[model samples]
Target: MRTYALTVFSQTGEKLLDESFEAPSNEEAKKIGQARLDETGYSEYTHRCVSPEAKLVLFHR
Candidate 1:
């Protein structure tokens, strides 16, 4: 597993939230991030996942 930082961004490009944790893979990290976003009821925004090993790893837009 690796540590990933999840960043939520507004539609206008402002940072909304940041969370860091571990996931087995980038795909799993994205799934977890999307699930987190689903609870927020804000779809207009986008998200990205970053890790020391993966860099700018995942993007859901």
Candidate 2:
């Protein structure tokens, strides 16, 4: 499994959420990240999910 970081930010660049999760692939990471965002009611917020290598798996502005 690979480590992924999921972060959510406010419009003013304030850090809202910063979490780490594991997934077998980037695609899976994206789904997990989105789910977490939705659960936290941050789905429409600025956010990004990045792999261990710093590749962006998901992003929204």
Candidate 3:
């Protein structure tokens, strides 16, 4: 498993959500991150999910 960071930000650059989760792959991390965002109703917010290697698994602006 690898550690992934998921973060969400408001339009004004306010940090909304910053969390870490474990996943077997970057693709899985992206799915988990997107699910979390949907559950939190932040799907339309600026967000990013980064892999342990600092690669972007998912990003939305």
**Top candidate, metric lDDT:** 2
Question: Stretches of candidate 3 above 4 Å error?
Answer: none
Off by over 4 Å in 2: none
lDDT of 1 at 43: 42
User: For residue 26, what is the lDDT in candidate 1?
Assistant: 79
**lDDT, candidate 1, 1-61, per-residue tens:** 8899878888788889888878898778777766777777544478777876767776778
lDDT of 3: 0.94
lDDT of 3 by residue, 1-61 (tens): 9999999999899999999999999888989999999999999999999999999999999
Error of 2 at 55 (Å): 0.5
Per-residue lDDT tens digits for candidate 2, residues 11-38, read 9999999999999999999999999999
Clashes of each: 0, 0, 0
Better candidate by lDDT, 1 or 3: 3
My TM-score estimates for the predictions, one after another, are 0.70, 0.97, 0.96
- CA lDDT, every model vs. true structure: 0.77, 0.96, 0.94
TM-score of 1: 0.70
Model 1 CA deviation exceeding 4 Å by range: none
Query: When superposed on Cα atoms, how far off is each prediction in RMSD?
Result: 2.1, 0.5, 0.5
